[model samples]
Structures are given as C-alpha cells and as structure tokens.
Target chain A: MIAKEKFRVCPDTGFKVFDTTEKLIKINAVVAVVFLAVGGLFGLLVALTRWPAVHLLPADLFYLVLTAHGADVLLFWIVFFEVAVLYFAGSVLLNVRLAAPRWAWAAFILMLVGAVMANVAVLQGESSVMFTSYVPMRVAPHFYLGLILFAVGALVAMFVFFGTLVIAKEEKTYEGSVPLVTFGAIVAAIIAVYTIASGAIILIPTLLWSLDLVADIDSVMYKLVWWGMGHSSQQINMATQVSIWYCIAAMVLGAKPLSEKVSRGAFLLYIVFLQLASAHHLLVEPGISSEWKVFNTSYALYLAVLGSMIHGMSIPGAVECAQRRRGFNEGMFGWLRKAPWGNPAFSGMALSVVLFGILGGITGVVLGAEQLNIIMHNTLYVPGHFHGTVVAGTTLAFMAITYLVVPLIFRREIIWPKVAQWQPYLFGLGVTGISLFMMGAGTLGVSRRHWDMAFTDAPLNFDVPPAAFLMMGLNGISAVIASIGGIMFILVIVGTILFGKKRGEDACRTNPVILPGGGATVMAAGSEGTLKLPGTIALVSVFFAAFVLYYFVNWKYLSEVWPLS
Target chain B: MTEHLNSGDGKSGDSNGGPENGEQRIHAMQSLLDNPFLLLFIGVAVPTVLYTVWGVMEVVQVPIGQ
Candidate 1:
C-alpha cells in the first residue's frame, strides 16, 4: 500500500509521482538503452554483411548476428521501454500509485534473465534459428525457454499496468474518462496480454518439441500461431508509439485531439481489427485459403488501416490547430514552419508520423495483398517496411520522448543540447535511406535472408541487377549513419542520466506543466477551440496522393509478371 | 492551465493529470473504451477468435505434407 509520504508532487507536471513508479521507469529505461546499443552493434554487422561491397561477416556469423539483432532490438529493447511507458502512463498520468510494486520487480527480473539466456543461446551458434525460430529448426532449449520466460514477464508487467488503473479509479485520481494517451496505452497493454499469451501457446509446445517431448510440430500450425505472437507484438508497438506521438504533441506543442469520440473510435478499431493484420504473414502460404487471406489482408485489414489513417490525420491536425491558436497563422504552412523544429521531441515525432505513414503504411497494405505479395514476400522489402515502422516510427518516437523523460522522470538536464536537437534528423534520415534502399533492392528481386547477395559462393548464381547491388551498398552505408545516430542517442541519454546537471525544484510551479528545457507548453490561444486546419488537410491530402500513386504502381508491377492460370 | 489542448473544457485530460477543476465528483463512470477490464477482455478475446483461433483452424484442416 502506498502512503502519502511515499508520494511526491512532481514540481513540473504536478502529477502525484509514486517513488516506486519513478524508480521502475528509470531502471526499465536504462536497461532498454543498454539493449539498444547491443542490438545496434549486431545490426551494423548485419547490414555490412548484406552489402555486396563489404560482406563483413561470414555466412554463419551473419545468421547469428541477424538472430541476435532481431531478438534484442525488436523483442527486448522495445518491450522494456514499453513497460516503462506503461508505468508512466498507467500510474503517473492517472496520478495514482503503482499497484503491486514487488510484482513489477519480479517481472523485470524474469525478462532480464530471459533476455540474457536467449542471447547466450544465440551466441553459442547452435540455436541460430533466426527471429522466427520456425518449426523443424530445432534450437537450444534455453532459446525457447528464454523467449517464453520473457513473454511471461512482459505479461506480468501488463497486469501491473491494469492494476494501476484500478487503483487510479479507486483513489479517484481524475474525473470523467481517462486521458487519451493513457487510453492508448491501455490498448497496447491489452494487445500485449494477447500477444504474450499467443507467444506462450505456441512456444511452450515448441519447447516441448525441442526436448523431443513431442514427436513433431506441424510447420503450418507453427507459422500460423507464431505470427499471432510475432506480428501482434508489432501491433503492440504501433499502438504505443502512436500514443507517444500524441503525448509529445501535447508536451511540446500543447496540442489536443480534434475530437475525443473520433480519436477513441480509432483506438477502438485498433483493438478489434489491428491484430488480424497478423494474418498477412500467412498470405503466401499455400495451406491457407484464399477466402481467409482475402478477408484478413484486404477486407478486414483495411478497417485497421483506416484506424492508422485516422491517427495520421488527427495528431497533425491537433498540432496544426494548436499552432494557429498560438498566433503562428501567417500562411497554410506557417503553423508548421513556425512550430518547434529545434525541439528534438517535436522533430522526432514529426518524422515518425510522416515516415511511418508514408513508407510503412503504404508498403504494409501492399504486402498484405495476397496477389501483390507474390512479388515481395520474404524479400528485403519486409525488413525495409518494418525499419520504417519500428525504427523510424516507434524507436524514433521513443527516443524523442526521452528528451522529456530525462527532465521529467529522471530530473536531469540533457548533456549536449545541440546534439540532442540534431539527433532525430540524423537518425530519421539515415533510417529513411536504409528503408528506401532496401525496398528498392527488394523490388529488383534481391533475397532478404541471404548473406552474400552477389552469390559469389553459390553453385549456380542468377545474376541480380547492378542497381540492386548499388542499393545494397547504399543500405549498408545508411546503416553506418543510423548506427552513429543510434549511438549518439545512447551516449546523450546515458550522459544525461549519469552525469548531467540535476534540475532544481520548480520555483515557478507553473500552471499546466513545465516543458523540458523550459520549452513552451501547449497553450490555448483560441477561445472557441475551433481552427480550420487547411495545412493539415493539405499535408494529409499529399499523403493520400502518395498512397494512391504507390498502390497502383504495385498493381502495375504485379501485372507485368508472367501470367498464371 | 493543463498542458493538454483541453482549452476551456476545465478537464485535465492531458498526459500528466493536470490541475483539478473545482471539486469534481469522487468517481466518474467512463465510456466502454475507458473501462480497462472490459477493454482487455474484448481486446484479448476478439483477436484470439479472429487471428489465432480462426487461423489455427484453417491450418488444422490442411492435409499433412507428404
């Protein structure tokens, strides 16, 4: 039970910050960054290995690095930070003490042990089954065990989040509906529970099969169940990052949603429809039915896509409305131009929204199409699309929020403010290049999983186009740049937390909340709360144009292929 | 003076629980979306049926590979 003495009123935000909640957030965030560095190192090796010019790692080492890269960054680093976000959202936003603090620690321990175990297994080289760790690829038992334990731990953290909500309500933290950011986090937590459970359902049996406790696991069954966990984990990231986008918009720009009902409705659509897009992974499988694929990919999946489009409109629309109200109303683009570009939080968020929507959202619908998938499935395009979503979108947004989290949660000023300002552009542009080049190579029919694109060692090599080789080289160079950006972020955050100057008590105790670095909090400059955001309308129209153009281009590409009866 | 864009609404619907509006009620009944227990139930249950269950059933009916 939390006592009054255990709670401190945050001088900046005025949220009743629980001592345990703050500590948990600090630990989770620090550990998450550690894994990010580890994952980044492995990822650089992977990119170099993929480059025809460099080909850094041997084939075996390449697979090992690839396995570690996927697991560490995608599964461990992201989830750990997400757990931190859950604590921040569920407890701090609601102004409630975290429920079951001891249980939260237990969850962290389980996940850490699992992550270490899984990493050790991969390094041993016998368990290099890659991220999917598909059926028939028997691995070291600890590999599956590590992942299983990790999932269970994450599942426990979600329960703690849920419990914190219940406590918020009991203590009467706030009146009316919960805030929208908290609402989005709840959506993520719920999806996480399902994802972790799905992981356990498939992995436990696979663990048994690895030990020869079961004779054989069906390949088709494994793929189907695995993606329920695999891809849904991504869906969890999508919801959470989108929530962070809203949080950042409010913090830096003081933006509000255009309409709560419409925004919440979009989140609701995610709950009902987002995970079905997981079936996109199985669209190429012959065992799956056309009826099932059609429904999952296009029919129902479009509803989920609509959910994303709604967010794309509303987040910027909110920002645009906020900017105009601030009297930045010179022209359609003035609000955007006069907006806080110097703020890494705002820039990172803007990049995440634009790149993810334009690159990830468009290619996602394309790959999900059962017909279109015939060209792109299992190609470099898949990773390219996710790099846009996870790296450019989610990871960048998370990095953006760290600018605030350091000052707000950690009570520290950023070490190098200028580097922090430029970090997002460097990382965002680097990853954009990475994603684009990979997509280009994929379009040219380059393989995704192969270590040597040149096939210098293959018995019989089908020559890939020279452009594909050029794209692969460009992708490798981009990875180097992104790696530098990623390392810069890690160094800045680490320096800030460990050595940067501590923020003094907010003598001002200003209304609303104080922004990090004494930046402007989003304010109400308009009386009616009504602004005709022609700029947002224009920006979104541009997005729709790009989407329409890309969609037909893919169809045209599909048509140029050999005819099938 | 809430950081969230809730200008004149007097509700602190921002990320940080903003300044409390004058002496609001102890507890408020939220919409179905705001109810975590109910949302978690439906979020988990529906996805299981649509993606996991429906998918596994389709895979189950497939004849074993030679």
Candidate 2:
C-alpha cells in the first residue's frame, strides 16, 4: 500500500495534494519569481539605456543587458512557472501521484543547474549574442550546452506530466474526461515536446560548431529550427495561460465555459495551426521561397489567429455568463461592470484577455502578413507587439493566476489584500503604455535592438523623427512603472508565503480568498442555463473594430513606404 | 448553475457530470482529450509534418556561398 502520509486533502476545495507535488509547485514558483526579479531589473536597465535622455548603459553593456533580459525573463522565468503549472494541472487536478517523484526531483535539479550555467555564460562578457544567437555569430559553448541541458530537463518534466495523466486514467482519479484545465495543459505539454525537440535539433549542432567540432551551421536552417523552438515557446504560453484563465474563472467566480465544445475546439485549433506561427519570424528571410512564404504565411498565420480570436471571445463570454446567472443583468456591459473588479483573480484574467486580443492579437496578425511584415519587420514595432502578447497578455495572465495559486497551493492569506486588488491594474497600465509607445516609436521608424537611437557618430548623420524620441522617453517611463508593478507582485506573494497567516487559522476571519468572496446570489430570469452574453458580445465587437482599423492603418503605412508612381 | 462548472473541476456530484461516487461517469467533451496517447500522437505528428519537415526541406534547397 502507498504511504498514506504522501496524500492529504485540501480542506477548502478538497483537492488531493501530494506532499511531493506541492513542494515541486512551491519550489518551481519560488525560483521563477527570483528569475523574474533578476530579469525585470535587467529589463529596466535596458529601457533606461534606450531612452535618449537617460541613456543608462553604454553600447556594449546595453547589448549585454538586452540579451540577459530576454533569456532570463522569456526563457527561465516563464518556463519554470510553466513547469509548476504542468504539475498542478496534471497530478493535482487528476488527483494522482506525480509519476516518478525521483525523476521529477532530477528534472528540477537539471533545470536549476542549466539555468545557472546559462546565466554564468551570459554574464561572463563573452557571449552577448542575444537570445536568438543566430548562426555564425557563435556564443559560448556553455550557453548552448546550458540550454540543451535545460531542454533535456524540461523534456523530463513533460514525461512526468504525461505519465501522471496515464496514472490518473488507470487509477480513475476523478471521473469522465479529465478537467478542461488538464486538457489545456496536455496541449501545452505536447507543444513543449515539439518545441524542445526543435531546440535540441538545432542547439546540439550549434554547440558542436561553437566547439570547433563542425565546419558550419547554415543560417537559414538555424532560423527555421530556432523559431520552431522560439515562437512555439510563446504558443506554449498562450495555451497555458488560456487554461489558467479558465481555472481562475472557475475558482474565483464559479464560471463555466459558455460552451465547452467551442472552448475545447479553440484549444484543439492551437494543436493544429499554432506552431505554424514560426513562419512569422521567417517571413522576411531571403533563403526562403515565395511559394513557401505565402503558403506558410496565409495557410498558417490566420488560422492560428482565428484560434486566438476564439479564445478572446470565449473567456469573456464565460465571465459574463457567470455574472448574469448571479443576477447582474442590466445593460450591455452590466455583467462586466458588476464583475469582481477588486479581486485580482478576476481582474487579471479579464485584462489579459482584452489586452492580449486587442494589442497583441491584432498587431501580431498584421505583422505576419507579408506586405505589412516588410514595413515593421525590423522596427521596434516587433518588440511592441510582443510586449502586448508576452508581458501584457501572458505575463499579466500569469500574475493574475498567481493570486489564486498563493491561496490555493501555498495556503496563505495575501499579506496585503488591498494592494493585491490593484496590482493587475497598475501592471496592466504600465505594460499597455510600453506596448503602445514602443509601437508608436516603431511606426516612426525606430530600430528594434540598436543600442543608440541618436546615431551620434554615424557617417550619414540621418535624423530620426523627434516624435520617436518622445515615444522612447515614454516607453522608458513605462518600463519603470512596470518594474514597480513587478516588484509589488513579488513583494506581495513572497511576503504572503513567507510571513502571512495560514489559511483558516483565525476563527473570526474565515479566509475570504480560500472560498472566494464577491459571489452573486441569485440566477436572473432568462439568464439561467442560457448563453446570452450581450456584454461579452459588445466587448468583442469593440475588439473587432480595433483589429479592422489597425489592419487598414498598417496597409496604409505600407503604401507610404513604397510609392506606386 | 455554478456547480455545472465543476465538470471542469471534475469534483463529485453534478448534473453535467460526476456520479455520487465523485467519479465522473461520463463527459461528452472527454472523448478527444481522454486518450492522452492519441492526442499526443496527433499533436506531435501534425506539426512535425506541416511546419518543421516542410520548413527544413525548403531551407535545404537554398544555395550556399553562391
């Protein structure tokens, strides 16, 4: 018989928490926050350096900071937290033991070591090739090796997740189809396997080339393989974040998906067409052919966009449906208005859905279009778009879910409940400014990754528009504000986990976070068992308007660049 | 209405799913995701063929140092 001590039940929700599983979630999340703090600091420095007036770091250091910022936040921070999410979704949600707890520990150690090794390589001042590290621009051999190790570790973690799912099925953990959250995680893990495999296929050879064991690694091949890894990493984020969006909605507001069929179909769409977005990074490449480009571009990009757009609607529709059932029906947006805006769990997910869809989703579609790609391909517009997606959309979504994670998994009261309420808005506002201003600077033709915006010593002495300078100044200020938001999130969570009272400890205060307050009591007529989401429809229609206007705007901008005369 | 959301949580006792035993006896959407192996195969195979294989082939056709 298994050790009874290994399995205990959460009193609040009755989730079967394995002792090892809980530790893995806590440890991985803790480490992810550490990297977020480190990476966010570098990001702030990079932003200051970009601002013409501030010019925080010199050219050499600017590149170093940029490279570190990408690797740490993009790779280390997000992936570590994702690993935690994977375990929670699989073992915890399925109510099964994590398959091979020994292997899980080994995976954690390998990941931790690999992350440190890569950081060491970057900080050593020799490997400042940035995250892409495109071929013939060799980075330290250790950099490639570190990443390879990390990939191997992640692959191992994926195995444990899959194995646990098998255990759930065989043991009959709960019943019927595994939770939708677990299903979304399954999609993420599958994407991760494909992504990490792509990384290995390219990185191993690159590592050999770095060590002078190979003559050449083709640049075109590198681009193909690397983006299969790189862009797909974000795809993993999208799938995982959407899953958590559903989870937070269910846990916080007791919301059901408006249509489970539509929501699952949307996730299924990701499995089908999402990775094709690798083409977005390669649209401008010369080694690639026209037929190849067009086929990949049109065939893949928009279908994937359709998948994201589906999610954009479903999340809000579910939220509004839940609110209406609670008797909040008044106007088109009454359900939205009465939503628990003060609850970080609800607000964070809502903001992520809106910002990601409007800013990230729409801008991304335009960028992937061959004609529009030409104009914004090398501009700060690219970074602007990603900030909207990655930081504003994915990171904010992750931050939102962390509110739930702390209470649910960590079993602590939020140290400062009032501050927790406003964290998402502050962070959301800052990143919104970052994405918008950067895109504005990009529109005025600012270079994406260049250290010096002024070009003080260039031979041509070309002058960038004064407006672009102002945009970068605004972007710098936004970065500082976003960093403060990041700090606040870290402080709130860290303080809570380290020092806050244990949940349900005080008899008088029943831990509002555990059961989640702000519930609506009665089901309004015509609302019960109906998917009438006028509020969500109005919200999505607004998104549609934004997308159409932006699409035409970019096309018009393209016309200005290339005269028909 | 809210407890209908438990089909997602898969907790016991619900009209949408789960019997009194806490084992969800049946779920309509479960068909696709229930089989981890099949989904894994589909997810991995579809992309490998569609994106990776095709892209690598195109890259291989490029002339070097021409």
Give the number of the best model, judged by DockQ.
1
Each model's lDDT = 0.85, 0.82
Please report the candidate that would top lDDT against the real structure: 1
Q: Which segments of model 2 are wrong by more than 4 Å? A: A1-5, A505-509, A514-529, B1-30
TM-score for the first chain of model 2?
A: 0.96
Worst 10 residues of 2 chain B by lDDT: B1-10
**lDDT string, candidate 2, A1-565, tens digits:** 6565387776655677899999999999999989999999999999999988999898888888898899998888889999999999988888889988889889988988999889899899778988899988988999999999998998899999999988877887665556778878999998898899999999999999999999998888898889999989888999999988878777776776665656667888888778878887888888777676676667776877787887787778877877776888988988888888989988888899889887898898898888789998888999999999999988998899899788778888888888888889988998999999999998888888889877789887758899999999999999988988888999999999999878763421465653333111101001123457777787788889989998999889889997897
Give each model a TM-score. 0.93, 0.93
Predictions' DockQ, in order: 0.29, 0.28
Model 2 DockQ, alpha carbons vs. true complex: 0.28
**Per-residue alpha-carbon lDDT of candidate 2 for residues B1-66, written as tens digits (9 for 90 to 100):** 122323432422246433555544444444555667777787778778877888788888776665
True lDDT of residue A233, candidate 1: 94
Clashes within 3 Å, all models in order: 1, 1
